[model samples]
Target chain A: MKGRSRGKVVARFGLLAALALILSWLESLVPAFFAAPGMKLGLTNLVVLVALYRMGDRAALGVNLLRILLAALLFGNGYSLAYSLAGGLLSGAAMILLKRCGRFHMTAVSVAGGLMHNVGQILTAMLLLDTWQLAGYLPVLWIGGMAAGLIIGLLGAELTRRLPPELFD
Target chain B: MEAKRKRFGRNDLLLVAGLLLLGVALTLALGVNRRDGREVVVRVDGEIVARLSLSEERELPIEIDGRIANRLQIADGAVRMIEADCPDKLCVRKGAVRYVGDGIVCLPHRVVVEVAGEDELGLDAVAG
Candidate 1:
């Protein structure tokens, strides 16, 4: 019974990955409403956050990674793969870490994840350019992260509440 | 239920406040000390193709004109476009960023104006 349940869990995790990829592609179709470069709705984050709550940690990680790779293949420049990978990994790690904390504040975790993604992306750019000058954008990214994170996080919370616990479990 | 008990610590507020103030200050400083004198380098695919060091001349030579080349200005340590054909002149209106993150981006042109810094020395090692 345990083995069968585990298989079912893995299958569900695969579905989550597919959902994340589709969300990623759909988000790209929506032109950024803001003026800042590199800004996007990041709608895929909703899927990742929801997966984190329902699917268990390994499933969440798998889904996030799969989405990043698939999304890069679908709509991103070849050169941008590294930045996206680094940013996604960093952001996902941040959110997971926050989730593990006793507080487990989903909203705060989302904000932290968003902020870290910006920082991670900027860090990669800085490292690649060998200049700290791009660091100036960090604050802008942080402010933007706050708003985006809050919106995404709250949405995640609502969806999680409505979802059948077994669907995620 | 578990996450709600945690409140933002003082440190978090302080850090956020510091970042905001820094962004505001940098934006203001860049706005006030606008200069018509500076040097600019345009790079694409991490290769430098155009270099413009400012003179007193107000007219700028635009090689690629699209909705992207709104208007150009060189101030302090930066070169920026104050106007553009792009419906969103956010790039043009940004004036010139003297510090890092200050770039002249022609999204339509796929052209970028990035401030060259000491890190240029490491470019060959990484990109090469």
Candidate 2:
């Protein structure tokens, strides 16, 4: 029974991971408005968050890693791998931590992940460039972060409500 | 049982207040502030492809492919490419968002035109 359950878990996570990659690619096609570099709708995050709520932290982490790898390869931007990894990992961690909190709703969890993702990306950029001056964008990023977080969080909240409960618990 | 509404905490209020202040400051600082004499950088895929610094008094028409942009004009102390071939025409409509936080991006063509006080600022922020 335990082995069967483990197989089911892996299969479910694999499916979620594939869905995330598809969503990531689809979002890339929606031309950005050019306010800044690396701006995205983060649709893949919605899948990951849904997977987290429906499955577990492990599944969410798996989906996150798979999506980043697939997106980097598909976009053909190897340099962005660092930024995406940092952002995805941090966001996933934040989401998992928020889930553990047991008080805040999915919207709050999504917001937390969104804010941390920006921070992670900025930190990665700073490390790659080897400069501290970029920190000035933190305020701007915070503003963008709030908006992005709210948007993604709202979507995640809706998904959370509609998702089947049996697989999540 | 009556469901209790969670009251906003001091930290939440502080965060919201900070956001408001920052929004106002950025709005005022970058609002309607044109950089006509500064250099414009066009970046694609984390690389600088074109650089234009227009200091001359005469206006120049920049044609992408064949058609001339309707509102793409740059004057002394301000630079703006107000038109493009993209379907959205958002960049053209942005009407020269020239600042650290302002940028006109053509995602379909992978073109981003932005005016900044210093190129180093962008490099440091994204590259650093």
Candidate 3:
């Protein structure tokens, strides 16, 4: 029974990662709001968020890593690849830790994750370019991340609720 | 453990509220008595080279060592790096700035263009 479920998990994980990549592509077409660079809706994060709850933290991390790598390979450059890696790992860690602490619900966990993702990307850019001036975008991006995270978190929670527990739980 | 994760709880609301509060505070801190630049201050190699007004629609090519290193344009109350000679060209991608604390930097040439608001150093409102 365990082996069978493990195989099923692998299959589902592949699909989830694909969904993440597809979301990233679609999100790119949305264009930058407020005419600001580096501000995104973070749609792919929703896939990782759901995987975190459904398949466990390790699986969620795998999903995020796979998506980032694949997306970078498909149509992203070195700089963008670095930015996504930093943000994805940082946010994934935050959400996993928050969930383990058991202090907040899904939405709250997602909110924090969202905020950290932006922080990670900004910090990465600062370090790469060797400039402190980039910090100026922090306040604006943080607000944008929180908004994106809240929406993604709510959607993840809904998906998790409707997902049948017999598959993984 | 799985059961505990379900449903939106009070702590979740509190967490979102806490983050929202932090975001708003950061914005206000950056914003107190500050407004978009009335003019852009261009500096190269730690020295001020020009003070271009945002109201004027003009482009200035910054010359260093008898060569144009970066170009600045101000229009519609915003400034951006229209051209640069750097290999990376990150300065051009830095986009336009309209508010205080916003800036575009060219690391290769050591050029720093920043937006200085109205109240940064008292009034600069006197007409020429």
Candidate 4:
């Protein structure tokens, strides 16, 4: 039973990771919609959010990291790797913490995740290049992130409802 | 405290509103000091490489390791990255920056171009 369940966990990770990568690719195909640099629909968060609520943090983080690495290799570069890692790690941490609190809805957790993700990316850029001027760009990203997060969070809430928690909890 | 709250309920709405307010407040505070600048400052790997006046029309290639990484163009009192060898080409897509706090960053090349003017002093004051 133990071995079988472990296999299930691995399988779950693979499925979710693949879904995330597809979503990333789909988002990239859409031409830059907004003038704001680095603004993204962050469609992959749908997979990560669903994993977080259904399979927990380890599962969600596994999916998120796997997707980032695979997507970067296939479609991005080293700098993009660093940027995505910063955003993914920070957003994952925020979502995990928020979910653990048990006081907020999935929408709230996802929204926080979205906001912190952009914050993390911008912070990484500032540190990497040693400039504080990027802070001015933050407001635009924050608003855009919020809009995208709201949509993602709504969808995530629905997804978590349809998918039951897996056995690994 | 509302553990039994529904998804995107009053609590969630309140949180969203609060975050939006924070974004707006930040915009006002950070934006107040920014103004169109007279020159663009280029930095390579965190060091100032050039300060070119925006009034002049010229193109400059930002070189890294004797290889041109990005082509910067200055015209109409604005600066844009016309070309970049980086994978994302985000710097080129960022369009033009004319405001004092606006910047075009090419992360792969570690290049930053920003506008600066006499009011650039406001930047230090704001940071302080």
| Best model number under TM-score | 4
List runs of model 3 lying over 4 Å from the truth: A1-6, B1-6, B32-57, B61-71, B75-100, B104-113, B116-128
Superposed model 2: Cα runs more than 4 Å off? A1-4, A33-37, A101-103, A119-144, B1-74, B81-94, B97-128
Error of 3 at A160 (Å): 0.7
Candidate 1 fraction of reference contacts recovered = 0.08
Q: Per-residue lDDT of A91-167 in model 3, one digit per residue for the tens? A: 99999999999788888898899999999988887777654556677787898889889899899888877777775
Q: Which candidate's DockQ is highest? A: 4
Candidate 2 vs candidate 3: the lDDT winner is 3
- Compared with the true structure, what per-residue lDDT tens digits does model 3 show for residues B1-128? 44555567888888888888988887777667457778787877656689888899999999988998889988899999999986567678878888776788775576878787766535433310
For residue A120, model 4's alpha carbon misses the true position, in angstroms, by 0.4
DockQ winner between 2 and 4, please give it: 4
Candidate 3 chain A lDDT trough over 10 residues, lowest sum: A28-37
Evaluated on chain A only, model 3 obtains a TM-score of: 0.94
Q: What global local distance difference test value does model 4 have?
A: 0.84
Model 4's CAPRI class is acceptable
List interface RMSDs for the candidates, in order.
Answer: 5.0, 6.6, 4.8, 3.6
Clashing pairs in 2: A54-A168, A125-B128, A126-B128, A129-B127, A129-B128, B36-B77, B36-B78, B82-B92
**How far does residue A142 in candidate 4 sit from its true spot (Å)?**
0.6
* TM-score for each of the candidates: 0.73, 0.63, 0.74, 0.83
CAPRI-style quality class for the chain A–B interface of candidate 2: incorrect
- Can you list the residue pairs that collide in candidate 3? none
lDDT by residue for model 4 (B1-128), tens: 22434676666677778888888898898889767888888989888888899999999999998999899999999999999987678889888889877888876688988888876645634753
A5-94, model 2: which lDDT tens digit per residue?
A: 766777777788888888888877887664544556678889988888777788788889988998899884755788889999998998
After TM-score superposition, the amount by which residue A133's alpha carbon in candidate 4 deviates from its true location, in angstroms, is 2.1
All candidates' lDDT scores?
Answer: 0.65, 0.65, 0.81, 0.84
